[model samples]
Target: MSLDLTCPYCQQPFQLAGEQPGKHANCPHCGKQFPIPASEVRLSRKVDQEPVPQRIAPATFWYVQTEDGRQFGPVTEGQLQAWYEEGRITANCQLLRKGADQWQWATDLYPDLHQIGEKKPQGAAAAKPPPPKQALDRPALPQSAAPITPLSPDDFPTTGAGLKSLGPVLRPLPPGYGEPRLHSFEALEDRRKFAPFMVAHMNRPPLNKMLLVLGIANFVVGTLRAVLYFALFLGLLGAIGAVDERGDERVANRAAVSLGIAFVMFVLNIFVISGGVGLLQRKEWGRSATFAGTLIGMIIQLTCVCVTMMLGADGSGLASAIWIVLLVLLLPSILYDAFAAATLTLPSVVTDLEE
Candidate 1:
């Protein structure tokens, strides 16, 4: 015959063969070991009627007190048992179940808790026999000797004779030994004032690193543009020479003017690239120079936009559209410059530069 069993820990119902009462079994679902209750046996009945399954209510929660006078929980009996088995709660610890009036020692309340995982010993060896006590009889001493008295500080001499007998006297420790050193209030107050700024400075490194990458990229692109412009200037010089040979003075003069403009552009590119390098090094002057250059570039861009609009009004559709696209592309750079300008002026950055 099979018996229906409910796991006390997990409340999972399972079938068990007819077995001894109070036998321990492991729950298949949660793998927790629990004793089978005596009331959990299947009863024989008529085959025509369906058997009504018995419902098991949840276990009452118990509270345990620590050795340090701290009380913890409303934990389940399973949890408390686990704690007991794990040695977290000792046998001497006090526990009180829900609706209980008084607290009691865990070992006194649950005597078999410590034997949960221990195997019962078999045979005569299981019953430990008490050791027999041996007599400690001895002859009494004679009464003539006086009893020894405990020594007191007054028994020792405290004068020059005692010092001479004891050898050289030890010197006292130098001044300030074991003394608590005083700190400056002003210094502590200063640290308190700059605590937030110090945090900001520590967090500033990531933004600074990003700015350095941008600076390097700007320098590299400017250098490449300068190289291209120089090549173009050489080509223009050749073209101007050819125009002069053909006796077209106006065209040659225009070519020379174009070459001059390219040379100026090359110089500006060199300055801009150098500024980018300085900015990467976080130089204060570099920030100022870059800010001035960006402001000038934005002004020039606005002027170009105005010119493009004027030309568009005269039916230059392609140029207007191209200029508008360029303006849209520059928006990110404009915002970045604005952010950089604001960040550079922060108190933390200023303090870092000073340092």
Candidate 2:
């Protein structure tokens, strides 16, 4: 490719082939080199900065693999159910979800979608004597399967970047001999369990996307926080005993009290960790534990900070540890807890978790 440039020294236009921005280039007319403007280099990036976020298509979302080799949809569970009932597809027909590699048999992907449909009114084909001739020995499909109720757009903002629009996109696959199926993470057997557990893996809360993310964050943060505080509790226990055996009795009592408080913090973090795990499993207790633990931890942490400040602290081990715990640890912990508690209460988030 060639780039158009005006020679800075000569004020003359010139074209340079095989040139990239940010390097010095000689002016053809004046024979003087000047640096290319890095300001306009949109593709340039700093290595220290985070990579841009990429969008992941919904996993449970699917496509109808037609016999004609032309696939249709970026369909949702509800849309797929509707298509099946209307006789547009069958249980044994091929279906390819957005993230799956091989086209899967409909019933294999969703056990509940077993070629059932609602019975037509009395003027249906069942009333007449069946014709003997048939092209395939396909079993008669049920008039209906259990109804699927997708989250209503009224309740959740479907247009958000994290979720596909309520209206399924019918865009055709791009022209290519080989595509998405190039990589398949799970084999047929592995998929058996994975299919059922996909919602948990998606790391997304019910229509309200924050719950899933919050759950994950809680799990990681809670785990690290628990380990940190628990270790401190054990160390404090050793110190409390040693100080009582050798140091001042008054300082020993203070150390014992600190040990008790450390124990409380450790237990609270454990509940926080448990809550995160629970949410991942879609259990109501998980959400409850996470929120309750966060709130209580925040209250205790704030009280400790206020009391420690009001009653001037000394240059002792317990006081220094309290300063670190209060300013370095609890401040962020309190902020995260506040956010998590509020997120848990979102109407959509609560409904999704409860359901």
Q: What are the RMSDs of all candidates, in order?
A: 25.9, 32.7
Question: How well is each residue in 203-251 modelled by candidate 1, as lDDT tens digits?
Answer: 5554355457657755875577579669969989899889988998877
For model 2, state the Cα shift of residue 269 in Å: 1.3
Off by over 4 Å in 2: 1-207, 315-325
Candidate 2 TM-score to native: 0.41
TM-scores across all candidates? Answer: 0.33, 0.41
Model 1 misplacement above 4 A: 1-210, 292-355
Q: Could you tell me which residue pairs clash in candidate 1?
A: none
Q: What is the lDDT of residue 63 in candidate 1?
A: 70
lDDT of each prediction vs. the true structure? 0.57, 0.65
Please report the TM-score between candidate 1 and the true structure. 0.33
255 Cα displacement, candidate 1 (Å): 1.8
lDDT of 2 at 126: 50
